[model samples]
Target chain A: MKLRRSERMVVISNYLINNPYKLTSLNTFAEKYEAAKSSISEDIAIIKKAFEESGIGEIETVTGASGGVIFTPGISEEEARSVIEDLRDSMSESNRILPGGYIYLSDLLSTPRILQSVGRIIANAFKGNKIDAVMTVATKGVPLANAVANILNVPFVIVRRDLKITEGSTVSVNYASGSSDRIEKMFLSKRSLKPNSRVLIVDDFLKGGGTISGMVSLLTEFDSTLVGVAVFAENAQEKRDRMNYKSLLKVSEIDVKSNHVKVELGNIFDK
Target chain B: MKLRRSERMVVISNYLINNPYKLTSLNTFAEKYEAAKSSISEDIAIIKKAFEESGIGEIETVTGASGGVIFTPGISEEEARSVIEDLRDSMSESNRILPGGYIYLSDLLSTPRILQSVGRIIANAFKGNKIDAVMTVATKGVPLANAVANILNVPFVIVRRDLKITEGSTVSVNYASGSSDRIEKMFLSKRSLKPNSRVLIVDDFLKGGGTISGMVSLLTEFDSTLVGVAVFAENAQEKRDRMNYKSLLKVSEIDVKSNHVKVELGNIFDK
Candidate 1:
């Protein structure tokens, strides 16, 4: 594992990139690379400068017996805006407008590059908050939640619309389905979230806001606090009680007759 | 955004790590960091050495007009075995056995750190294959597919048991549900995958092998080729015809009465 100064920094930065929100003692790196603690410290200093300048993230060093460096993943505002702009443009395509006016986003959401960028943007929006887990509904929301969770270095809990035998004991709550407005039970494994935990709710798209509200109530059932809510897209035309949340894209209009869709950057970009 | 050699190396390695299997020309880095192509070449040389030594991945240099470096993510056999061993131990927990002998696996699959490790291991298993997409069923398989797709830098297409309006027009296939032996239909969006794609079928668990078979058929329906099949775990007790696949863990027994499950490293480790 011994590497030259240049090689060492490359591997060390790679480590920090993969392991965000983690604290690793200088001794660990020093021993792994057969370098002195002072050498590792100097390496961290150079890495910190590179990461901050590149907008990769910030590296904070802690002093004391339990001291270590923590990597916090981040994205520059310019890069975030650029990513959203691209998404907005992609979403505005007339072909994305489906028969029922539902925009086809599976193609975008399932792409790893898109998911990773969206994850960084959404996770950066709530950078200062202490998030325990990312929560989302099954199917479409799973990849989005996983992306955010990867960046935040937290677990993701899926709220299922249907009961599955694989899930042990679960806590269920009825929430109105988005456009249907029909009350539907959402289930969360009882063991998934601990009591008094702080969670961020994430979803693929927002319409009636019912699904988000349902997840908020489920948080209450588990005695967990809602850190915040973020969605990939929100329908501006959907008339529903305004709940505080962030979205990467806002679909102002979906014209099924004309096969047109108007998309704009969501409220998350608001200064 | 000019940086010193140390800083440039850090950011370049970060980019290669995040964008694996992508070819980035030295000229791009040279222009970005205000360095010469020779300097960037030296940086890649050092990085390639470090990456190989640490089992991070391989950095292949393609020379000529389309010249650049392509990073292929990899893991040492030791590292992959260690990861599967940890998963095996986790899966063997007595409390993981749910009623009717179903093993609870949501917790391990949802944790970002675990998911990332599993992704690297699984992606490493198929390092030489040309995987255009990672295909899996909805819900439980989504996170695993996302993880592998992230490492491979490919899109993951979710095949759903129940169709959603947002998926648009989809192609459907019938399969027998594991354990239940009841026939069920799985759907994949027509636009989700392109024709003649080389797809890698991934799933959370392998039961009766019906789901994988169905996905394979769907790949045929789409005129795509099946590169391979990889599952997180497989049930050894399930009496089903043997098939070609790779699994991280093999569950030999799940005894509900004793509340015990036996898990071992799977065939992926076989010499």
Candidate 2:
């Protein structure tokens, strides 16, 4: 496992990037790479400088015996805003507008590059929070939740509209469906989430906020706490009451007749 | 963005790891880091050696004026086997068995690290193919498909058991429901996939292969070609017709009455 200093840094940086929000001792790297602790420390110093200068993230070195260096993935405010702006423009395409005022986001959400960027932006918005798990309603929100969960290094739970036998015992909650406005039940596997989990909720789109509310209730049902709510886009014209969440794109206008959709950067960029 | 040689290697490795299955010209790196092309080439030489020695992946340099370096993510067979073995043991846990013999897999599939590893293993199984999209059924299979799609840097399309208005128009196919042995319809959004795409099918579990068949039919319906099929696990005891797919874990036995399940490494490791 002995590596040259440059190769060691490359491998160490890869490890830190893959295992974000983790603490790794310099001794461990020194032993693995067969280098001196002082050399490892120097490597960390250079890595910290490179990461910070590139706005990739930050690395903190703890001095105590039980401490080590921790890497926190981050996205600069400027970068986050630019990413969302690009998404907003792409989302405003007329072809994305389906009948009944729905926008087709599957294409964008399914792209890894876009998902990775969006994940970084959303995770950055909720940085410094203790997130034990990410929760999202089934179907469209799974990938978004998965992306955020990946960045956070936490498990994600999916809330399904229909119960499946494979989920085993489940707890159900009734919420007003956004599309049909009917009282509908959503189910979460009983074993999917642990109690007292601080969860961050993520979804692809926020319309009536009913789905998000249902998930919040599920959090309470599982004895978990909500850290925050984030969505890819929100319908600005929709009359929503008493719900606060961060969205990357705001769909300000959707004229189905003229095939025109107006989109702007969402409130995540607001100071 | 001009960084020292050591720092540049770290950032370039990060970029390559994040953007696998992508071709990037040395000129791009040279321009981005404000370094000479020869220096960037030297950096890649070190990175390629580091990556190969660490089992990270392979960096192939394509020659000619239109040539560049393409990073193909890979895992050592030993590591892949060990990962699947660990999953096999975990899947064999008695508590994973639900009613009817279905094993709960949400926890494993939802974990980012596990998904990333599984994604790499599954993607590596079909490494030589030209896969344009990863296809799977909704809810349970979305994350698995997303994981594979992320590794491949392609879009994933989810086929739903029930239709949603948000999906716009969809192409529906009838397949025998594996659990109930009843005919059911699955729908894929018309816009979700393009025609003539070479798709790789992935799912959380393969029971009767009906769902995979449905997706295959849908692929044909969309004028797309099937590159291959991969699953996180497959039911070995299920009496299935001839189906060619790679699975990481095989469920040899599921004794619901005694709450015991037997799992082994699946066909993914088969030569």
Candidate 3:
């Protein structure tokens, strides 16, 4: 499909935006759009300028026989901080506090706009690292993991607490359920992940870090390496062993009696 | 940040691509780009042409006091058919059949590119309908629902088989489990969805139709309306009560003993 230079750039930018972290040869675009290689090269240069100027992402041109352009999605630090601050404000709402001091986060995590922004922030923090996949435990963490994985253009492996017949064979690990303090099993389908994968772990909330620890152990069981960990929110009041992770929001206080909650930007922005 | 007209068009097109199904005033773009409203309007015209010509989507200008442009994502018939055909081929793999005639779908659902394409196809099927939210059962259906929600720019609600404190107060309903021939309960967080919402239900697989029914009932309980139901795949051999839905792939036969499965395109393509 031949297109004008402007229209070609629009569609090419769209393709690159959709397929982030992917390398596509300029020849592919040239042939698809019926444009010369040099024209496609010019298109990429303009797209790169627009993308970088808008802080949408960076487009890297790899030069070699097998080289191509790679688009990496990113967010400006100002935008990221503002997004987190808005989240912190929403999370501080008094009604979000449950009876047992647990702050309700389902609403926040379920929203697409919020999830997309949070995904950008977390993925940007670990931008230079080689991440093959994103990992998370079942239920709450699935969406968070999916968000990050979408930005990274990688598959997400969900570790479930209950085994289903459809999963076939799975590898299981035991972890202490921080809320219940009960030893429970978390399962990941054996075929879900590959060995030697560098995975980034993501979750909706972090408290005692027991679940993340469990996932870390499971990664070892699968011979996968942990690139890093990130969470949507963390309970700052909970005292636990130091775990290296980035969080977008920190819930410093949740007083159920007074119906008050205190929230702050998490360590994700820390230098 | 001011930009050249071509650069502005690139960024404006990117914004509309990311924020599908939502109306944005030209003034917003004009102010952001430091361009005249007429320039932004001209930019939208070119983007609309580029988007429609490329099968990316359609941009409709709503003219009124509360007027703006709304982008509705779309995929070409050829592209959609090819995507489903690819999925059918993958689903037909003999090794995908498990002991109980269940086909493993974790790998397909976890891949970002596949999920995004499937999401586009499903969302496009329900185009023109007001979809305030996407709904699905937990574990397997979360990613599919998330994908659709992302395309629609709406939040997704997860119906879970088991209750967790993190979800806070929830509304529970009972549904029959087709595989086990047993009745089971499903729960949705009370605060996750707003009342009177128009929801689109989505799932990874459709064998029983019970889970989708349960979600429909839950929607009624919340005083919400069901706009439609769409699934990634459905079992044709399994006898199920007529359920109104669209599925991308239909499994006509799953012969575990013979290690073969018959797959076909589903009703989603039906006129």
| DockQ-derived CAPRI band for the predicted complex in model 3 | high
Query: Lowest-scoring 10 consecutive residues by lDDT in candidate 1 chain A?
Result: A175-184
Among incorrect, acceptable, medium and high, the docking class of model 2 is: high
TM-score of 1: 0.99
Sort the candidates on lDDT, descending order.
Answer: 1, 3, 2
Off by over 4 Å in 2: none
Candidate 2, residue A162: CA error in Å? Answer: 0.5
> Tens digit of lDDT per residue, candidate 2, span B30-136?
99999999999999999999999888889999989988899998899988988888898889889998888888888998999999999999999998999999999
Question: What's the distance in Å from true for residue B157, model 1?
Answer: 0.3
For model 2, residues A135-193, the per-residue Cα lDDT tens digits are 99988999999999888889999999998998999999999877646999999999999
Model 3 C-alpha lDDT per residue in residues A1-271, reported as the tens digit of each score: 9999889989999999999999999999999999999999998999899999999999999999999999999999999999999999999989888878888888888899998898899999999999999999888899899999999999999999998999999999999888646999999999999999999999988989889999999999999999999999899888776789998889888888889999999999999
Q: What is the per-residue lDDT of model 1 for residues A1-271, given as tens digits with 9 covering 90 to 100? A: 7789989998899999999999999999999999999999999999999999999999999999999999999999999999999999999999998888899999899899999999999899999999999999997899999999999999999999999999999999999885664888999999899999899999988999999999999999999999999999999999877699999999999889988899999999788
- In model 2, what is the error at residue A204, expressed in angstroms? 1.1
Q: Tell me candidate 3's interface RMSD.
A: 0.7
DockQ of each: 0.93, 0.84, 0.87
Q: What DockQ does model 2 achieve? A: 0.84
Ranking by DockQ: 1, 3, 2
